[model samples]
Target chain A: MAIKVLHHGLATTVQDLGRPGYFHLGIPVGGAMDRYAMRAANLLVGNDEGAAGLEAVFIGPKLEFTEDALVAVTGADMPTKVDGVAQPGWTAFKVKAGQTLTFDFLKSGARICIAVSGGIDVPEALGSRSTYPIGALGGYKGRPLTAGDELPVGKSNLASEGRNVPEALRRRPGPSAELRVLPGLYWHRVTEESQQNFFADEWKVANEADRMGYRFKGGRKLDFVDREQPFGAGSDPSNIVDSCYPYGSIQVPGGTEPIILHRDAVSGGGYFMVGTVISADMDLIGQLQPHSPTRFVKVTMEDALAARRVRQLNLARLREALA
Target chain B: MSARYTFGGDEHLFVECSEEMSLEAFFTSLSMAKGVRESGIKGVTEICPANASLQMKFDPDVIHPNDILKEVKAIEGAAARAEPVLKTRIVEIPVFYNDPWTHETLMRFRERHQDPTGTDLDYAARINGYGAVDDFVGAHSGSPWFVSMVGFVAGLPFMYQMVERQRQIQVPKYLRPRTDTPKLTVGHGGCFGCIYSVRGAGGYQMFGITPMPIFDPTQTTSYLRDFMVFFRPGDIVKFKPIDRDAYDQAVEDVDKGRFAPPIREVSFDLREFQKDIDGCNAMLEGMLNGH
Candidate 1:
């Protein structure tokens, strides 16, 4: 099976769960930012969790399926249409031969994952099929999916095994305001006021935000003696001292604004990691669209763990339901 | 620059577990911790290098944040009392220092530095060179150089922060920060900050080339993800610079399996085409894996 890319949306590219442990090699983990949604979509279409699929940002593309295909779109609740007919989100649908799928303006979230039944058959790079746009490597020719790009589908009958996106899993996303975080690698470095304000304040996603990092505006500016600090934005005049791989919530310099690292964040960073959005809450942050106001909530490690436990149980339930 | 530096307490969490200790002592104490031994944290994770400081990654479900704090407090003394296994191996890296800065580049660096004294300019040029002395010279006459952190990107290792004197003469960043710049340059050939998975434009200064491949996907054991790097927040590094011939010999030895990268470690040194070499290992991984 194959699908012709009629119009590549804002920033569409094929991604999977992303490559980990390679951060030390100067490779960013460029994968589905909203992994939870990506997995759900893959399951909806009877594909494995790590299947290569389209991570369409802003809006999805118009595609023409050459043969019958089963597809599912997850993440955003945008206005998606099939052959000029409104289609529902979070469900599997069969596109007959020569069917055209198009997406309208985004109603929420920055991106969505479109998983076809027989996962995209792109050549693997380092055991993954994610795209790294900056270096022009990986994914559909090492770049975002472009108009007229033809993607071949792996020969598999996985779609015959029907899977469903449970109603609970299909629950509409919550308010884009409050964000949850665990104390960062250097959370204590910020002033108490800054820390308090960080959680209390609402910051708008700056225009500069991208897969590399989400640069936000208006938390609290750091007030420290302008000595050559080693962490954060503009902290070091030279290159950042190799430190640790980013685990999300790496605070770039200028503590005035905080950056929530995303899937494509570099492995090691010099900036002080102000806080990491807990694993359970990371998908929430990932789904946030630009200009969405977000606030940080300091969850104790216990709470973070509890949240993860809930998510784990939820995943188990999802798998059982699919089975 | 040596004005008594008193770190602000409110801003930073400074848990002084020891007044003075060697890398061996620190490692020993950490390796023998109760949490690591009893909590089953060791087997659960890949590499947990116990050094002067044991940076434990907590799974929120298994370990609470407060529990980690309690663990840190309870283990600080244990880490202090413990001793490290001191079986050290010296990995010789090959390097070729390339002068990429033209007159314009030099001028830009000069303009970036607020105080462009001759010494400052010299220091900018020395970024490539100074890293070598700082890592190998024992940080000032037999002073033990501690391994501050083991960074990713072929596991580029960072020894310690620059000395107070070396901090005085530093270069300024160019007008635009290049995110795709490779982590290692002339001096700190084995330094971290190399991107192993993602390739992007960066602005780190480039100087030398190292023949010892820091990373190569063709090697069977190479997995940007599986190879766990060994270095802790406070392990000691004995930096020793090797010339071009030694670098070539090291590469030859590595290729022949005389020095194959361990199942946990990956390393590379860019001694030629400073720009491309920095990202070669990561670029190769991406290309090899179809990332």
Candidate 2:
């Protein structure tokens, strides 16, 4: 009926595909950062792709299954174990009543998703169970799960253990990643030389990476075109009138670092946005570790659309392989 | 009116109605968002109408981005003719100006402030040409402000004063972003007043704290039983300054589920207000006082 928390991970929260229609109200589409992994894990456990699951960051949570259930862990290269017995990543396995689940040191990635056969049954808020700690909405009490909390589980459709996803199908960041971006309207605010340098320079994922945004450092600071500061804007060159920040939009606060907003981003702000990372690359961002080297590649609108199609086809292939 | 339409990414189309923040820009964004919604544009997962701008999140796979762009441009053209009027509510928000919570927080992050020697309220007052904090508070609470945008965090409303441009209070943000701001803390920056719905990072110049909840995700507050978010984009707010005893009493009433926010439904016409700015604001305030 429930999964009792033994040891809460560094930051484990309930997530689904997220509530999508509330951004105008400053509500982000709060969900698993690595959405592809969440869908894959749910598929392995025979649950709906968008079913609520536990998204743990860096460290894994110690959980005790109160009843027999099927579970799958996906996203990172973390070693999973039940009752101290090793289990394969991206493969559904069975855990008996009173059995404990734990994890070893993270091998490569920054996050992991554990999808149970019966999805985590947290009550829906704004049509989602995703935890948005900023607004204190959804999930287990609108924050990270803590020790001694019993998480309710939904009714299962039943799946046998040993359902495995192919190795290549499981996406993780390599030593370096090239995130494609499409420059938007605010791109003009930045100097032309700086725009070219942005693509030329390499960037490293700063420690500021989280559900809200991924800050990239180790790159040359961007220069702006000198202009009289607009009314209702800050004196800094990087400031714009407070505006909406679309998911994946790269905002350079003070022109120093580019923070690529992710799932739990604030709806609007005053920073100048240079561009937005293509949607196809956002899931890969969630798996990138701190200090991971990265590059920005500019793409046209057509190229972006093509990449999105490729991602859709990839998900389709995943569904077919699981079916 | 002019707008720049650009692709945010494969999934989102960002439309900047203006480069500067103005009531006209906000009205255009609201109208465009309404146009797109009424057009029933397919594949639009979300439409965010921000200050001076708007964004639409669409699934390119369903309706191609190019197609949506064409449709949105057509909608924008038609929206130009639409009347700029809104049926919104006016709510009286009780604020304890120079409250202890925001005062402590502002003092903690003074190094980030341009004038570190003075409190945020004092600094905000001094720069705006007020000799006393009471006169500043009177100016702030005298006029009903329009909710220009509701964002930066959940249910936090960014407001513009009802007064004309010359009388507007403008202040710079923190020299550096602060790591924290008290929840329900009333803040001002870049000619906009904002209420921090929850405790988190902020860069605004803090002035006061509100006893009433601006946003409650749990839907537990007495006034928020119907909706978790208390403010919307088109709402009007009048800040009513209160003493320490009323602030404490309001908090107690909230705990007992007896605090009902002062709200009144009213019709607002943009052109009407612009024609008689002071007169309309006085009328609006009178309506709220009667409520």
Candidate 3:
């Protein structure tokens, strides 16, 4: 019924599929950064795909269950142990009362999604259990979990112990990732040579990357076409009149480091957005770790849609197999 | 004017009504957004109308991106032929200018400011060609501002003053953004005024602080019981200058869960406002102040 936290590692919080439909009022669509991994973890534990789960970044928490439960961990290749016994990820296993769960150093990826048999039963705010800590809303008390906080788990009737995701379906973290993007909007604002260089360079994820945005370094300084800035627009050459920033939009302020606005980013801003990471590749961004190299590949709208269809089909197949 | 339609990846459609910030463009965007919402497009998930543009998030699986684009275009075409009548609310917000908290914060981040030697108000007043800070403050509070967009954070409204181009007050943002800003601090940057709903990093020139909470996630206040956010795009806001005594009283009322912003319902005609900006603003201000 409850899980007691012994050690809160790095940043850990409850997240689900996010609260959509309120971006107009400036509420960010906050949720698990790695949607695919979160769904997979929930499926492995016999929970609904959108069930609330714990998303831990950098490090993982040490948790002790008060009642018997089944749990699964997905996304990162974090070395985990149950009651001091090593356990494999991407699979569910039973844990006895008072058994402690902990993780070792991360081998790859930046986040880990842990799904309890029943979802983390936190009060839903704005129709989501996800946390927006800046606004102090949703999740467990609208903030990251701390040591000694007890989280309540929902009731589950399915016998899900020992369920596992196939190795083919498991996503492995890599040193580099290719993100597909549809270039438009303010893409024309950048010089043709700079636009070409943006796709040509292999950028490394900066340490400042987080849920708000992913800043990439080592790319050539992007240059914008010189023009008198319009009224109301800031003096920065990279700034446009304040406009709506789509989720996954990429903007290069000062034409230096390119930042990809993410799940918890500001809904709109004055910066010129050159491109947006397609829905299919957004999951890959969630898996990108600091210092990981990433290449932005321009893809056609048709190809992006095709990739999305394939992703949906794969998710459906996984759900069927688990059922 | 025609709108420039572009795609923001596969999930969003970005519609630019105008290159410059204008009430006519905003009204057009707002009207088209309303049309789209009323049409009940199958896949449309979120509609965000900004200063002079609109961004819509849709599910490609539910409806083809091209189809949504077509529907929005059709809606825009129809909206363009019709006069825009905006149902709006005039909100009177109390602000204590040069309050100690924001003053302390602004002074602390002076190194990030354009003029590191003087306070933000003095710099802003001087740059706007005002002899004294009082004149600048008077000019700012004299006119009502239209909420062009609600973004940058939850419940944060970006406002543009309703005035002639020459009368508009403009100020540049900080040379570098400050790492911290106090919540409820009224700030101005470029040509927009905003109330920091939740304090975080900000680059705007700090001016004053408001006691009324624009955002209450707890919904403890009666005004925020139904909606956690206070302002919506298209709302008119007038910042009323207040003294320390009034500010403290308002703070006390807020602490006691009794403070509510003064608001009145009004219909805004875009064509009328465009014809006479001063007259329209005066009428709106009169309605708000009950003069």
Candidate 4:
């Protein structure tokens, strides 16, 4: 079975749960940004949670299936349609051979996840089907999907049509998001007043945000404690001796704009990372749109762990309910 | 002797060896990383060792964060007590100093440079008290460098020279980052030297270009068949200066999938090297040239 692309949309690519165990080699874990929604879409089609699917940003793709398949659309509220008829997201439905599927302009979130009954059958690179375009590895041809591409689909026996996730279980991406952070990798570098301002103020997401990192605007300039620069650290007051950066670490260069490193970010750098967004809030970061107002909420390690436990339990509950 | 361990949320543990970059600190991190990897911890996803620090990612559901921390602490303690003996390789990488491509790029981004009037090499040479850029190049290529870390991008190795501390070269990064850098551009920033793995934005002071590819996702070359990245953390790299003719030929060989960098196997003993850097480097050079 195959799905031929009619329109590739904006920045669409194949993604899964991402490849682990390779970060030591300087490889970024490129995967579906909103993993919660990706898993939900897969579960709706009765596929394994780590199954590969199409992830599109802003605009959505136009695809024509060559064979019968069960499919589900989740994440952003990009109204999907089959043969010009409107269809609801968070549900599995059947598409017959020669049927066309398209999506409307994004109504809520910045990205949408589309899961077919069988996962996108791309050859795995380093044990993952997720695309890392910077390194030119994994996913479809190690790049974004373009027009005239025919993606092969795997065979599935677990999927059935007319399955839907309950409304209460679904998450809607909003215009504003609060990301929880554990503030202290190099938090000591910033002034106490600036640290307080970082959490107190709402920062607007910049247009330059991408898979690597998100740059935020409209924040007070952070001031670093004065000290003689270390041997290898750059001259910038915000720079530290080169160190490892966490997956969701936040760094402000020149103390003006704060950039939050994401899944596909460089593993380490010289900039002083002040805080890291908790794992529970990373999915929310994926859904954040350009120009969206964001606030960094400080949380203790215990609180962060508790939040992670709740997310895991929710996923388990969803799987049980679907079964 | 004590490593500062911090929580990067609940999923990652950041262990810093020292605030300053030193061979001892790097060895400590490498030994600790090896220990953690060999322990076969169930939830450990990644064990990344940086210049003088180590970061580990784990699944909290399968392993408690504190449990991993305790293990890391124990490993660090053991590493501190014992001498680190690492199995390493010495590789000779060919570089063409003041290559046209990087020279042009440096000229284009001169306004973003610390010294806009002169070329990157000239400025670097002047600041380092060398009379000519050639002298600077000679000093840079004089000794083999240790691959202290391999990151910022896949296959991008941050190398530190094996020379004494007083003779080490230091240069600040660009005043502002350049929008484009040619792939394989050999660059220096602060006290570290690096080769750009892919064409992208960079702030490193451009000095030359390497004719060979350090990273190949396709894994077409014989040397890269087993792994896409050419350099590892403990590897030793010597930058052999080459002329335009050799550079072009090497590039052609790489393009035709026949390029193989000069590689030699060697065992690196941290304690011995710390005692006598020049003596150890001479022995390593003999092994490279003897082959």
Give me the candidate number with maximum DockQ.
Answer: 3
The 10-residue segment of model 3 chain A with minimum total lDDT is A157-166
Ten-residue region with minimum lDDT total, candidate 1 chain B: B1-10
Encode model 1's per-residue lDDT on B1-291: one tens digit a residue: 000111111111122122222323334433434345465542122122322222333444454445545555565555444443333322223343332322234345554433355322244445535555344232221222334434433344444322232332233444344344332343322222121222334343333434444433333323223433333344333223455666667657755656533221222222221345325433433322344
Q: Encode model 2's per-residue lDDT on B1-291: one tens digit a residue.
A: 778898888889989888888888888998899899888998998888888889999998789888998999998887778888888999999999999899899889989999988898888889899999999999999999989888888899999888888889999999888999999999999889999999999989998999998788978887788899888888999999998999999999999999988788999998999999989998998899883
Off by over 4 Å in 4: none
All DockQ scores: 0.12, 0.85, 0.87, 0.78
- True lDDT of residue A81, candidate 1: 78
Q: Write down the TM-score for model 1.
A: 0.69
Candidate 3 lDDT for residue B101: 92
**Which residue pairs in model 2 clash with each other?**
none
Docking model 1 quality class: incorrect
lDDT at residue A291 of model 4 (Cα atoms):
95
| Chain B vs. true chain B: TM-score per candidate | 0.47, 0.98, 0.97, 0.97
Give all candidates' CA lDDT scores: 0.55, 0.91, 0.91, 0.89
Q: A1-323, model 2: which lDDT tens digit per residue? A: 89999999899999999998888889899899999999999999999999999999999999999999999999988999999999999999999999999999999888999999989999999999999999889999999999999999999988989988987787865778899999985899889999999999999999999999999999999999999988887788898988899899999988999999999999999888998999998999999999999999999988988888899898998999898
What TM-score goes with each of the models?
A: 0.69, 0.98, 0.98, 0.97
Residue B20 CA displacement from its true place in model 3, Å: 1.1
lDDT for residue B43 in candidate 3, whole number 0-100: 91
User: What is the alpha-carbon lDDT for the whole of candidate 1?
Assistant: 0.55
| Range of the 10 consecutive residues with the lowest summed lDDT in candidate 2 chain A | A167-176
Residue B102 C-alpha lDDT in model 1: 27
Task: Rank the candidate models, highest lDDT first.
Answer: 2, 3, 4, 1
